[model samples]
Target: MGGFLSFVKKETLHIVRDRRTMMIALLMPVVQILLFGFALSTEINNIDFAVTSPNRTEAVRRQVERIAANPYFTFKGYIAPNEIDNALRSGRADAVAVFADDYDRQTAATERGEPAEKAVQLIFDASNPNNAAAGAGYMQSILLAGRQTGAAAPETRLLYNPQMKSAYNFVPGIMGLIFILICAMLTSVSIVREEETGTMEVLLVSPVRPIRIIFAKMIPYFLLSCLNLVSILLLARFVLGMPMSGSLAGLVGISLLYLMLALALGLLISTLANNQVTAMLISGMLLMLPIIMLSGMVFPIENMPGILQGVSCIIPARWYIEAVRKLMIEGVPFADVLREVLILAAMTAVLIGVALRKFNDKLE
Candidate 1:
């Protein structure tokens, strides 16, 4: 136990010795949190809204007033019916509320038990889907809220995700990306550094088995990655307001499986690369691009071409992120994630086997 502790202590010290790298690693998540908090948001706080009314009924004026008074929209006043295209094209309005010429009559007739179609039309700029969806929903809610009960036959109800927060989609992706990169890069670089510094030979000659040494070396990074996983979950739940709708134990179990896969992949990279730089290049750039582009992190895999989709099947983050979204967002049962768990376990076992084989050969 003492000897194992010493080995872990040494590896931890080695990891933290580089102040610059340590700072970058620690601050990277903070930067991501800031960017996700501010820049990557799809919440529609302020959207420009315009109105078009041929007859300028009191009902239209009241509706426009309500929209303008609400904080979600910036009322851009009324536009001519002919200028709808111009307004939308010029970006002068994100959405235009069009009222029928007989809007007042429609409302009055409906109140009197006479049939009348929808008197108001909502035209939105679909260029920004977030704005378009949110804006249209906002306007619909406002209009519906103003009407009496039974005035509208149908109602809109958003279940599970009522607010439509975009962070829910991003949190799992970021977690999958961040944990794998940090764990893999740290493990690979530490091993490669020992090789580069000529210290590996001295360690290899000692009483410890090569696999034991490699496993011991990986211990610190695994714990660190676990802490990182916890911190990420906390950030996702509290700061980002993302829900832990599923089982916490389930999330942790799956994440630890992914971490093992990441560390094993790092070992595999360390076996391939002779130096720290090469290991970092292989782990960072080579892994990052595929994870970001093909892992269904930022884009849907089903939408990709057959070749890219096939390529994505091999990316570890693809399965991990998919499992996370299911567990964290969709709140599926543990049984639901059996496929991801099985695939990741197989990948981890294969990587560990291959890495250990190469490591033993190199030691011999």
Candidate 2:
């Protein structure tokens, strides 16, 4: 009994002594609860709603006021018919309300000679099928609020995904998850495994600078990640029948940049981890959850709590998924993805710089 108790006590002390183990044992549950509490939401809120009226009649103007008064929407002011496409592409609006030129005259009762036109047109960015559907429902309730018996339902159209396919949303999200999994987690583990087995020191003994040496180790993984990228694109295009509406070259270029950023992120992770297991643990704990929850993959960021939404801005996968969705699904031009590209580039540069500075010369 004494020996058994001693063994248990020794193991307990070992776990308590290892900070990483302690964090996983004690803090992981805390993190999971917090994320689930604030980040897991399907309800649509804070939709950026815009209105476009070629002719602003009293009826159209009054319907616009009704939509504006709704708590669910952020009422972007009236835009031109020509500006609707640009507004959606530029993220200026989530859904646009378009009124026909003779809307008021057409909606006039046929008790006279006039025919009733459709009440309004709701154009959604539909990259997220769920959001598009929910936004349509919300707009319908608002537009047809008092006139449920009289008004014609709003004419709803989904941009980018007229079919409203869920596949269009998840494919890019899966690509983001896979790129980070292969490039960052695998690279981190491979480098840390070398450190664990002392092979890293051998490679570092060469005349080359240590940063270059460490990064050279990442070359094979980067190539492997590229192969995975090609595989995903092929499957997404051929098997899934997803449309590649934007510039294929632009998508490929941005994907390569994302892969590089993932590689740098791996190098940074390896610098922090002492052993292969720790590297994998840190990668899973830090990278996986954020990629799933905060990357805007399964959940809409705008629906999350303010702090988690802000934290999402720093998550590399969030920007990658957004860019991919824009190019792959929405068919936005390369210029339209400029903001995402710049943010990713800045993140890559920062991670690489930190990894080089933090990498220690001696194996401790």
Instruction: Tell me the number of clashing residue pairs for each predicted model.
Output: 0, 0
Q: Which pairs in model 2 have colliding backbones?
A: none
Candidate 2 per-residue C-alpha lDDT over 64-148 given as tens digits, one digit per residue, 9 for 90 to 100: 8888887778899999889999999999999999888887666666425466767578999999998999999889878776345
Name the weakest run of 10 consecutive residues (lDDT summed) in model 2.
28-37
- Candidate models: Cα lDDT each: 0.84, 0.78
Best by TM-score: 1
- Would you estimate the TM-scores of all the predictions? 0.84, 0.60
Candidate 2 ranges with C-alpha deviation above 4 Å: 1-151, 360-364
Residue 215 local lDDT, model 2: 55
